[model samples]
Target: MSLLDQQSVFSAMLQAGPFAVGDTPPLAHPFSRETKAWVQHIHGNQLLKTKYRSVRNQIFDLLGIATYDEVLALIHDKELRTKAAERAYLLLGNMFGIEGTGQEVIRHLHEYARTADDVISSLRAKVLAPYSAHIETTNEIVTTWDPVELLLALFDDRYHKKARFEAKRKLALMGLAGSIDQRERETKIGEKFLTFLNFLNAFVWSPDCKIGELDIRYLYSTHNRENFSCSAVKVLSEEEARLIIPAVGEKLTLVKRRRFRDNGADIPIYVTIRKKEPSAKVLKLLRKNEKNPATAVDDELGLMAVLNSVNDVKRFVRHLTRSAARAESFMTLEDISDTLTGGEYRGTATGSSGKTSMLKFFARTGGMRIEFILHTNRSYLNYIYQRDVAHDEYEVKRIFDTGVIEFLFPPDIYHLDLQKIRDHQLAWFRRRIEEN
Candidate 1:
């Protein structure tokens, strides 16, 4: 990350201190002083302390270090710091490079004040644009106007007394209602994400070599009959999805109800894709700093496959390896199936919570590294429907669990009770899953 970006993050942290709402002054302190204050605040709060350490440990692993001492020692080692900075750039700046210079965060309160109108306007447009046609369907709101827009606009236009109280009350109940200043950043990141997905499609279905299905059959648990294997050939729309095979419909519905949009089970492929959003990318970078942009890009194109049984999953993986070998593009593979299948849930986010079981590995081929997660029917069901283990719950947990929510939308300025919001989101996701 750039110095400016670091300062921006630090400036935001300062605003989270115990100052009155909108009463904090400009960040005029030296970097060390600002960092000290931030550290003091974190250390003073038990929850923040635990979450901060968790985030630190993740970053330490990404940087290939083990302790805080090494992190502090980097300042004196210019050579190591330069290399670390490059890695940090690749890690944090991976998504559209927006966190750094592309479109830097507005660090100062004065800067935000100057752009308040634009920020509020842009946020209003963003939150409403996607849900405009169906905004009323969302149970979160009962009024004609969105609470977030109304709150921000009222707060911005000098209606401070009521706005402050209402904003605090609503935020306490709802979490950070909408984003603050991520105006064009989301669109840029989404465009890149789509391009990355397209590249994955080309790689998987290339003319020279392609990932294909095996001719093997398995006695599906639901059908109790042997069925031919199938690969993901095409995506399905809601209408086509309605015509899903009876045996696969339930699993397909579970996967489709996931928060991510890039997944479907119209065919036997049972594939799900994962690409970190702009905010998620930033939070992940804040978690850990890895080697290169390849890891990030590979993650953006990560693929998951759910099959009838463990035997079938292994067969499918064998077919994948065989296809890669035939193309002479195979590099290496990591099979952690034994570990996951041994009743141990794989760690996620902070490496402590949001766990799930799956046969996971990474394959390097054709100058690209792709991750593949294989799941048996039973495990896949557990992944989606299991209590405290469902991915939807995981998604809701990680944001607040890692303290990224507070870092990005501090309670003092945003007036958001992150824990309350987490509960609301988790309940909301569970309701959607139930409806599905």
Candidate 2:
């Protein structure tokens, strides 16, 4: 009767009549332009950072996990050794975009489990803080706020402190204790975060993220990209849900699954197990949509994958900064204050509303090179309607102005597997997208 017994627990949990299969209704979008525009960072814990897909894939190679999702599920386990594999999986994934299926994940699982300092951290800073409502643009004016400032305001309220306390708990669960000042600590957690971000991209959020009175701020930056792609990973109620982890560790003990809500109000989902093996389904959709055959795919796609990744990153960083600055002008309405107090207006505070580009985007380091993603919020869609902004036109200009994005993960990501910076060039073009 070791805690989290596999067979009995699985039967009881899986066979239970009360357990939910899933929600067929689409989850609420958390990062609408309004919500996302305000959020620059997801509350800095030093271990958390801006997760890039290129870095995520590279880590897939080091720790021998199939994907970072598995690592996330495993990290919460009490069995340290089993969970160590999950962390290693993240390391390996950051090193290489893809890892071999079965044997390697198991083979390296032991070695990674043995290490004393298995978990690492990654730190990321957003150009915008919660109060910022403007973006600095060469052409358009922007506003900005410092997250530290928001933290100051939050210190007065118990709610913010509680939120931070929970954040700290999650960091500790990942073996990331109190904050570290060194870049080294950041690199450790950052790699893991990036990999996890890939696995949890579905929950990353929308351009808009309004969490009650808390305004998660984003930078308001602008670029000229006109066309972009958006990826959605949707699981229906009847679909099987599996946990993703690469290895096992000392504290990797399985526990019960708990439902939690994300900023947008969608509940975060995960798998629970009590034993050695983690639960996960090899991504069928990505595999099926993959244009390249398995044999011919690895090298051709791998090389271009890393290259295009570089380009997408550069652009995201550029635009994120711009977007973060865009929300400075919006002041809290006096009427809202009065309404909250039944017309007894309190002194107006800044940052009630902010603007965000409905166009959300990212660069994917892939089994195939996924160059650009242009994700936009339809909230401000009405404004663009009069201008007739074409997505294509915007993309062309963005890439032309910003060049290409690149991966910024730490070294040993793949131990030179993906370090190839072979001759790659970006073509020059003027393009724009219509937003009607």
Candidate 3:
């Protein structure tokens, strides 16, 4: 059966009952061999075995296998079992957003298998459809823009086309991002991080985010129309575009400043509350074994403070610290503000030099851990628009360099050698930077 058909079968098995019967019983199905091998692989690996134990019952129940020993007993042919194990890891990893090979791949898959459905349900609830009230705008000032427009700014700015096709192609290559399985996996892994960001959004607008007589203002974004409409993706501000242009690679170069429009609401500094994008979250999980979909929730909620001056950025942090202390609700804090304090400049991807600058930390408050990223106007500009140090460029580099693009988008399926495309994009992004 095709992967989609396999997914349908598993989904059906999970949803309905009366699992095994007839000539093609659950155990007799073609998938049974691969699953049996998967069980063996998990049993053989110590780290994966521990994770398997936690969700052992769920796995057996979902797969319609009565018990662990029952599945193992059927694993007869050693060579066949070994090959099946490899195939199982690769296909299942692609479907479920698990990364890497061997023990770690099985570990991520097992850890999240139990909760995939729940994550899907939660995401559906949040994504309001058919033009409901925009609740995200009621509390804070929200500026909305079409994601297609952002893409247009890059790829089809002069042409005014290709955004939809490019977006669709990218999504398909990225494991059909809109698929039920991928959505559930991404949401489950990034749940805590997203929750923490929601908490921060609430806190920012609350009276608590104040400095004595002065109240802080935060500008955020949300879908301005029906969830499935063209307006699903919002607009990026001039400052936001800096990070986005490089982050988005070469296709999204439609930076028409004159066309950029929003409600004429002014705030001293615009605070962008970003819930880490789902694709980025998946890449992060694949990047390391130490993080799982559930327990690892730090760095999910990113708060980017774009200030007018370095002095303003410093002042904002000082006030933020005081406000958190005043509430007496903070659990722990890491004041990693080397740039603001004139301490050792330890910034950049490698942490060797101080070139890539930003003041960042994790704070536990409102029962959620959030990463606060503070950047001065000048620094923020450089971070996004700079030739070698653009955030968008870094995103492009990691997606290709880590082999994630290839892993998720296999040649047989995508029919595109993404490494060459990666090189092309990196070069195109560079040219765009140099030109304007």
Candidate 4:
């Protein structure tokens, strides 16, 4: 065959997504006609058939057709004909490259594509198999959403009022909601939140395991009981906690400080650690939000890296991502640098100037999920100010919203001057931003 003809065959194969065993090859609709013509031209020539007998046989098997005439008859079934033509194109292309019989192409297909039964069985063994062990105790198999399930729930409720409320809250926190139309604003927020959820999911489920087994206790020291005052805390071995904290913290701090120095900042880098999610927040998340307690409560153990400059923040994030990729302990997810802003709670200004970047990752062992919030010194200072100043009002609003104080305080009391408090925080943020 001419080089042009050979290129045409190879191009057609490339257009197909991937080859699978015992299934029709998926072909690009546009190339169907040319592919059919090429097959017919080769099939009709006895000399070509003799030289490419293996290719011809494989084509016949792929299309379930016995002869060249049978292949032509496939024109009546557009889908079948397209698939047959693609198979022929792939087979001929393989033969041309390897100068081998069509068996090579068949072998390659078998290697890459699993049969339907094989795929189903493999999935059952790898995925459903874990749950199978708990089948005897089905009643005891406390249901929990994996990251994928939580994501699906969010998508399903994309148009719901609650999701819209959540989206608006997200935008309000970012300080970009006022500039856009309500619908458009909600859509942007929804997209961003979905992206955030996706990153969270990946960070929680990398290496692909069931989510419920993730133990947060592995991330902190057992001596750090004070951090768990807010959550359903578990105290694991002090030795395990000690090993994890220093090993992970050292790497994270080293990266942050080195990056800060590299960015020409002579400031000290500060690292803050949280042992577990506060018990109250975990209950609220599980009951009010209907989130899977396993992956949903990711901040159960958290780390924050406070740096001296925004450039240092970016550098630290890059270094941490690279480090996670190299380390066996964790896998980094999509970075949330762009979405980082001030507080998400009620008291802080909707447009708080507390700027920070967030990176999330999944622990390879014990299914622990960890987050690192990167912040410049100024942003960190702003965060502290907003958090402290807003603490009282924030707690009051939370209590009212959760109905913890509904019996004591009337509903009208819930209408506090949240924006005023926010304005104060925003001023602080503004000053810090300006100073930086």
Maximum-TM-score candidate: 1
In candidate 1, how many clashes are counted?
0
Tell me the spans in candidate 3 whose CA falls farther than 4 Å from its real position: 1-61, 65-267, 277-279, 289-291, 294-297, 330-332, 335-337, 340-354, 412-415, 434-436
lDDT of 4: 0.35
TM-score of 3: 0.44
Residue 25, model 1: lDDT of 22
TM-score of each: 0.47, 0.15, 0.44, 0.29
**Candidate 2 wrong stretches, greater than 4 Å:** 1-186, 194-377, 380-392, 402-436
Q: How would you encode candidate 1's per-residue C-alpha lDDT over 130-191 as one tens digit per residue?
A: 32332112122122132223323222334343344333333222211122223224434456
User: What lDDT does candidate 3 reach at residue 187?
Assistant: 49
Candidate 2: residue 7 lDDT (0-100): 24
By TM-score, the better pick of 1 and 4 is 1
Which 10 successive residues of model 2 have the least lDDT summed?
276-285
TM-score ranking from best to worst?
A: 1, 3, 4, 2
Better of 3 and 4 by TM-score: 3
Candidate 3 lDDT score at position 228: 10
Q: What lDDT score is found at residue 372 in candidate 1?
A: 84
| Per-residue lDDT of candidate 2, residues 1-436 (tens digit) | 2111222211111111111111211112455553363244324522222332333453344334565344434334447434454555555434433357645543433322221011211111111111112211111000111111111222223233223322222222121111111112333434534443342233222324322212221212122232222121222221122332212110111212122232234322222111111000001101122212232122111101100122332343343233333422211211111121123223211111112222222223211121122222221221122122333233323222221111111121112221131111111111112221
Alpha carbon lDDT of residue 57, candidate 4?
Answer: 68
lDDT of 4 by residue, 12-109 (tens): 11111111110122222435865565566667565545545664464457556776555435645567655664565364334324334556544433
